[model samples]
Target chain A: MTSDAAPAAPTNPGLGALFVGFLTISIQAFGGVLPWARRVIVERRGWLSPAEFTDMLSLCQFLPGPNMINLAVALGVRFRGIPGAIAAFAGLIGVPMVIVLLLVTLYEGIGPSPAVDDTLGAIAAAAAGLMIATTAKIAEPFFRARDWRAILIAAIGFLAVGIFRWPLLWVLFVLAPLGVAAYWRWRR
Target chain B: MGAYGQLIAHFAVLSLLAVGGVPTVIPEMHRHAVDVAGWLSDTEFTNLFAIAQGAPGPNMTIVTLIGWHVTGLGGALVATAAFCVPCCVLTYFVFQLWNRWRDRPWRVAVQAGLSAVTIGIVAAGALVIAIAADTNLARFAITLATAALAWWTRLNPLWALGAAGVIGALGFA
Candidate 1:
């Protein structure tokens, strides 16, 4: 008896899985989603590896938009197909976007109050810490490359803005090309 | 054609300025809405900004708050949608080709450039807020202390916020 060989089918993540993952991440996206997104995909779901997660993050950062939304789309597509990408994008952006609108409702009625300034001052200060944290966290990986060119560029950029008090746009314009040259030099 | 349009334009700029995230541009938004446009006073802007931060989700919520203050719920809609559109569209295209050139040359350069710019903008925002936060020694203490606590604490940042609130109640900035 002769047995016929069959073509293998393409396996894909199910729609239900996409719905659950997207909704879950969206609802929980407080403060930030990067940490949680990494958790759910790498740890909980086992969909992407640690290396893959890091690559996705870098891509999100390199792009010109909300890193969180881009991440959800990229990872979702990897796991659950295009439908999943859409689901994740809508879920992540849609949920928080809506919440912002709703909160705006009550925000206007607070009226004139000095207490707001005090509280916002504190919050703003805390937000600064987060920015500092995010910067260090993102830069930590690049440190392993040990590229002195990058170090000089970063230092120059920092000095221009922090010390000389140059406008941000001007610094970016000058330093962006310098960064490109430095990265090219190091990579080559 | 009106003040509302001007407000939306301001938010659009802020949205684009949201380099790392939304909070980095909070000071700019406050400056524009309260200081430039005169839509709201500093007290009014600060109060709304605080509520927006204390609420939840991304810091972009300030756009909606400013919008609501300037106009109404409709203003809120305009601000939120306008702010999001640029980021969304830009990210979508980025997502489309993300896998192909994840490690391409310009990509690496842009990422490096962004790190420096993000730090600069965030620091700028912080400086602006610090100046505004100045009330007296007590308030200045809250600002410096909160920065230190945040740096040291492994605890969630909300704790720092709550602590600062108590400090604020004591007539600090």
Candidate 2:
């Protein structure tokens, strides 16, 4: 794992290459795109190391919009500037948007069959579990570093958002600065 | 404004407010689409969420579906672009700034702080979806089983999702 202290040298893929890379990632991803993205960018393309991918993902998660969308933009801009970012973003989302629209049309035609409802219900349940697992995976680094303060911050955040149903913006506003300050103090 | 115009304006604000990604805005999306705007019913909102989850690519496609419900193909395009473009531009500029200050102490602090908050936000997102979807005991079991499988094993999530779908189709869950 590469530490945040030192990042790997850039692979500097071209705009066309980024388009193709993201296109493949979008096609290959079924339920979730993040795992496939990691495989393609880190292992297959060598655009980023595992540690660098983790670092980038952390930033992407913090930003607004889809994490993968933010990732595509950041990676694209990193290599080839704004046009590169557009290429990556378009490749990532264009076809998938069409596919999703088609699926929605089909679903509407099918209407409310009990079997379809059941299938969708089970899928939703599983998706919820997948979200939980994703959270655990993202939190693995903190556990490994024994970062108790970070864990406490995460707990507070979960309580505020999940239990209390506080406005997300307010929760982030309150927790983010406090978290930053705490970590900074600990480092000092 | 027209429906298309309303969708663009509404989702554009949602685009920036999506802190931990699209799911974090589910409650707000529900509020707008179901309660405030009267565009979709409660059942429709939940169903759209499920459809987006089951579809390929990003789950944020729910926004596109909502736009489609409001108008048609053009609405889908408008909603998706409005929801994605602003944030993409922001990320592009921020990435340049981040790279320049990669080794700064405050950057490190910000990263650490934000990561923890992100985890919490995601967890909350999961909880919200679980409450909405797990309406029965069998569904709850499926959720728990899948979560355990994902956490304890290296199994592909698609396989778990498929198996659960089969169970549901069979009228078991």
Candidate 3:
């Protein structure tokens, strides 16, 4: 089955458009980048349809490294090959990388101060809350579907890495294959 | 190998293993950078993570900050590139092949399994950071409240973060 709904989708976003599109995403990505990336690529730019966006995102998520970075590369390559990949990657990372480094410099210059420590401490707590919310959102779908195998795998993962303080490499080595096999059998 | 080379090699391995994204590899990074390499204190590690989370951009910024902490600009550049390039290259080559096999039953199983495990790993990361961050009852309460707000509401999390900062400045949390 052909994937495209229509054979002649008129847009092959130029490298410049890819760069500028991702640049906008990077600048506005204060807490998380995915939503912004979706808004820009799927909605604002009309580069990928909603289904295509989800499909691309799932692929990016499945592959290793930072999902968003992989997303930029995949999208870039999908549109315009290796050079496009580089352009999208550079655009997505460039301005924000500089800003983050600058922040680090300023933070270093501040040295160790009580007020700064307090502020950072509180911020860290809130950031953790954000992470918790993120996990809940991701897990919600499986929970809703009563997917016990997935839930069990998740619980094992949490215990192994979160509570036991095990090395992640060993944990993944043991868990990944078993999880995959379990899922495969369950699907049959 | 030189420091940059070592950093690259270490992160390149981490890059591949970073299934689900940077957060999945964070505990490992923390273990190496803080516990193993002794590059930073526990406080510094968590603080830098907070800063990265607060700042604009992708979650990769935390990796960049860690590199910057270790060896200034050059380290940051090297670490970011090393973490990104190998995996991006892998994605570049694999995406087309993967799409062709979209209907494979094994592929679906793999995705489902990996995603569940990834969620679990991310949850573990949240617990690690929460323990590090919630030093007092007030701060702990703030974390719980923020979690609820973020989980249930459509509000942008930046607002919660800002309010938490304000509470900290006022010495309430």
Best by lDDT: 2
Q: Which stretches of candidate 1 lie over 4 Å from their true place?
A: A1-110, A140-146, B1-56, B69-71, B103-153
Per-model TM against the reference = 0.63, 0.82, 0.74
Off by over 4 Å in 3: A1-64, A74-88, B1-59, B62-75
| Model 1 error, position B150 (Å) | 5.4
lDDT at A176 for candidate 2? 86
Return the clash pairs for model 3, or none. none
Query: Model 3, chain A: how large is the TM-score?
Result: 0.66
Total clashes, candidate 1? 1
Candidate 2 lDDT over A1-188, as tens digits, reads: 22122224546799999999999888756556775576578656779865567678868877899999999999898889888889999889888888878877887887768898788788778877776666666677778989899899989988999999888778887998998898888887
DockQ result, candidate 2: 0.56
Residue-level lDDT of model 1, residues A22-124, one tens digit each, is 6666554333454346445544465665445565665554444456655766666666656777777666655665676565554545554677656655555
DockQ of predictions, in order shown:
0.24, 0.56, 0.49
Please give the clash total of every predicted structure, in order: 1, 0, 0
Please report, as a value between 0 and 1, the fraction of native contacts recovered by candidate 2. 0.72
DockQ comparison, 2 vs 3, better candidate: 2
> Which tens-of-lDDT digit does each residue in A107-172 have in candidate 3?
778866778668767877887787676667556667888989989998999999999978766777
Give the TM-score of chain A, superposed on the true chain A, for all candidates in the order listed. Answer: 0.59, 0.76, 0.66
